[model samples]
Target: MTDAYYDFSPLYRSAVGFDRMARLLEAAQRNGQENGWPPYNIESTGESTYQIEVAVAGFKADELSIEARENQLTVAGRKAANDAGDSTERTFLHRGLAERDFERRFQLADYVVVKGADLANGLLTIDLARELPEALKPRQIEINQPKPTLEGKSAKSNKAA
Candidate 1:
């Protein structure tokens, strides 16, 4: 994190409603090391909806945890300790799979909420949606239309003159 890859303070001076983005960038810069370990893909599933799929090859459903709070989503995985003498336990010949503990943080946009998550076939899929409030959604505004008058004030004045 010493390389200072992202310096967003300068843009903060003139920027409005972008602090969340800046924080996201800074968090990514700080957690650069843990960003690449668990490969993940973010795909748009619908209008204002998204799905994040993380490659958790050797993790079980109970070994993983997902939490969403304050517009930030965190997914973590931890391996269970091996039993003293398990009948089905076997030694790995080459040990290539990285089943190590890891944590991944995702910064969500405004009003984005985690709907649900599922772990299947070594892949974790999390669903999110941008549930914009009613006030923020587009709506029709009634425009007042003046009623037609038989004679306006200016016209009456001209007739009197």
Candidate 2:
């Protein structure tokens, strides 16, 4: 696969604290042509909440794993190899379903965290939430009125001498 280069110099020059976003965009463009396997979906469940659902047919709970570290979420699955002595020798005419191993990763934004995960009916759902720090959360700033000057008059006062 060919790696494509993009010029984000303009964005870097004009934007502040957006370096992570630019890096994510570049990484996505580079991997845009990769194979799609073990399809997944990301949905917003509520304010500051999200869910990721992945289809993992034919895979037992023991064969799958999910991990969250720093700002990355990774999901991996592997089916145990069948022992030669356990199964009768049988030839398959056609194999359509994919039971192969797969690994998928997602980049999470700042303050985003994985709350929990569950698997039901062959679907693996991962819950997430964004919890911003108190300092980062928006707050109303009080606009203080100007105090009276030394001349015994307020800045906004229009009393005639």
Candidate 3:
């Protein structure tokens, strides 16, 4: 039988010591696939800003979490009892709403960071900003004037003197 191996080290090369860690996490994700949970979108807010909106109908602000460590953004959700003693048992004719717990991760760029998160009208919006490093920015080099050549004037006079 042939051996099956998966390598995912390239995804987290920008982060320190996270290459191997990401590889393990990716392997685990492939091995144990969970239920397909929520609907989301990633929008380019501007040149340096991005926003991720998830449709979390039943989840509240406390039930969801947005985490950014190294070069990865993870969105997780947990179902908890409502404050007004709501029922955990959801009955649906078509059964489309996602009430199960889930964790979704996205690989971010080198300078990308999460700004904040907001929940409104059954939507959770997470904002991200990309901050480039000073050294990585473009810098213009100054062109200096060329020095004068002495060969045009001094050779014959200095030898005769």
Candidate 4:
């Protein structure tokens, strides 16, 4: 990570536990490059559901692959070796379409899993949902009410006398 971002070095020396934050900062710096090839979109479908749409124009289903691991999602497309063919055999005067291979990575939140992916009409859409374990989900705890003590009941009887 850059030194301008809080000078994370002191976090390791002066702080007791901020290593995870420092590591995350480093990862962010590595992924901060502005490579705009193959545009994409992220939208919220539900309270805990999300969808990512990436333009895979010239890529086929077989040429693309998606994998999620350690809170990171990677989508890569590799064209076949013989797809373009020999220049002598096939030549293009104007090749505007980006048939070149590319890979995109996204940082996912905790408990976020890639449910499914579909390639349709040159668009690759990936569905994700946050599935928290039952232990982590909020639940109503039943608080037991204490029964009336015998001492309190005897005191009430004495007061009545």
lDDT of 4 by residue, 82-136 (tens): 7455666657899899888998888899999999999999999999999999999
lDDT for each residue of candidate 1 in 1-161, tens digit (9 for 90 to 100): 35547578976777788876787777777677554879999999999999999999999999999999878899999999877687696788898889799989988888999999998898999999999999988999999998775565666686898
Off by over 4 Å in 4: 1-23, 83-88, 149-161
lDDT of 2 by residue, 93-112 (tens): 99877989998888898899
Show the lowest summed lDDT stretch of 10 residues, model 3. 27-36
State how far residue 50 of model 1 sits from its true place (Å).
0.6
TM accuracy, model 2 = 0.69
Best-to-worst ranking by TM-score: 4, 1, 2, 3
Best model number under TM-score: 4
Q: Write the per-residue lDDT of candidate 3 for residues 1-161, one digit (tens) a residue.
A: 33455666566766786665776577466535644457789999898999999888988898998888868788988988455776576667897776778787777878999999999999999999999898989999999997775776776786887
TM-score of each candidate? Answer: 0.74, 0.69, 0.66, 0.75
Collision pairs in model 2: none
How much is 154 displaced in model 1, in angstroms? 16
For candidate 2, the clash count comes to: 0
Candidate 1 segments exceeding 4 Å error: 1-22, 85-89, 149-161
RMSD of each: 5.7, 7.2, 6.7, 5.5
